[model samples]
Target: MEKLVEQVWDYTKHAKFYSYRPNYAPKTIDMLITLVGGKNLKVADIGAGTGNLSIMLLERNCNVVSVEPNDAMREIGIERTKGQSIEWVRATGIDSTLENSYFDWVTFGSSFNVMDRNEALNEAHRLLKKGGYFSCMWNHRDLNDPMQKIAEDTIIEFVPKYTRGTRREDQRPIIEARKDLFDNIVYIEEDFYFHQSIENYINAWRSVKNPYWDLETKEGNELFEKISQKIIERLPKEFDIKYTTRCWSAKKYK
Candidate 1:
């Protein structure tokens, strides 16, 4: 196993932590489906956390190959996609162990940042046919919303080192500099509205992440509670937030 995969898979293995995550809007998935433009196409969804994106592709009648490294997370994904016909493989993005020049589409749903980004791109390029599409997408909180701003501020205050807004932005230059790895690169972002309860929202934050996972620790527990209470006291019973789902895609040129 690679160092990055081993480190992330071991530290973040809890499935319940992801139960409250906000789902990508149907329109977002629809756009991806339209891009690929065919039924029963082979799609590899790496970092398929809890099978969110895989489930969508399966519904569209695509043959989805879900590859995830964490057992707990993959187990939950298996459970979520039950009764559906799909392939599950335990693998990381940079080295999925899948054969080359076969799949019609390769996707990373929110896990691209955790991967060796350039290597993953190389692998995705290898796995796809010449005309195959590669897409990476994840939802971002629209912090321009005052409620979201409050949430981010509280998160940063407790975790001081948190880079909620800057993590993806920090990686932009890498994507820009590596255009040689893929061709006709383009980015598309769409804003979608979502509604969730405060309790569910906080629990979604409790995922098995480093420093933030061990809520049993004095420091961890305090930080977790502080953010939770602030959200409850501040937000309404049924609050809405805007989520921007961003997708980056390119083609495997001949």
Candidate 2:
């Protein structure tokens, strides 16, 4: 499974995947800024694939350390932020070589599930200053929404079985898993709404190398073909997919 994930991460260097990957919601970025009480705060974005969240932090005038494991993704991050003064490091959450109490905030956006949760949590604790914030953000599909349910169910049936089990849309497990690492744990959730056309939605999935790589078996491909047909036959040409962007912040006590 780990090898499979590594292969998928390597494939993310492709032009289509690098260019069309979905970004973190602007409102989610604003919430992170608000949680830290201001901008220009030193930040470390863990598992910072292609610098999606790092770019968001940089846009707010914050100095960002983008830690990513995949060389391809890290290069894209560096390329995109060439003149923006962002520090791009090829590192994962667990082995980030940063010293203790180094950053004001450590953020994980849509990349938490791919990490060793326990190691990553401890690393975040080790890197944050006293009273510093640790945040995890994800753009989750609202399973209760009819359109979201359709899209999600289709993807689930088509993708590799393990991918479905390994990742989840809910944030509770991650928050609960890391609760003991921080003294003052708090959660804040905000909806980042977007109207995604059917093509846009499909392309977004295709662009995520991990998920697409997992959908490679003959059975999986057949399932995906069915899904694509269903999407074209039933879903509106343009429709809305609601996302619940859940963010949890925990502060280290002095």
Each prediction's Cα lDDT score?
Answer: 0.78, 0.72
| Per-prediction TM-score | 0.90, 0.82
Top-TM-score structure, candidate number:
1
Determine which window of 10 residues in candidate 2 has minimal summed lDDT. Answer: 1-10
Clashes of each: 0, 0
lDDT of 2 at 153: 68
Candidate 2's residue-wise lDDT over 1-254, tens digit each? 23323443454534346445456678767876887876579899998877778888888998888888777777777888899867887667877878789899999987777766677788898999887888887766667877877766666766536254334556556657665667566666666556777777767665454555445467655666677777666678887667777777788765
lDDT of 1 at 232: 79
Quote the positional error of residue 95 for candidate 1 in Å: 1.4
> Residue 105: error of model 1 in Å?
0.6
lDDT of 2 at 126: 94
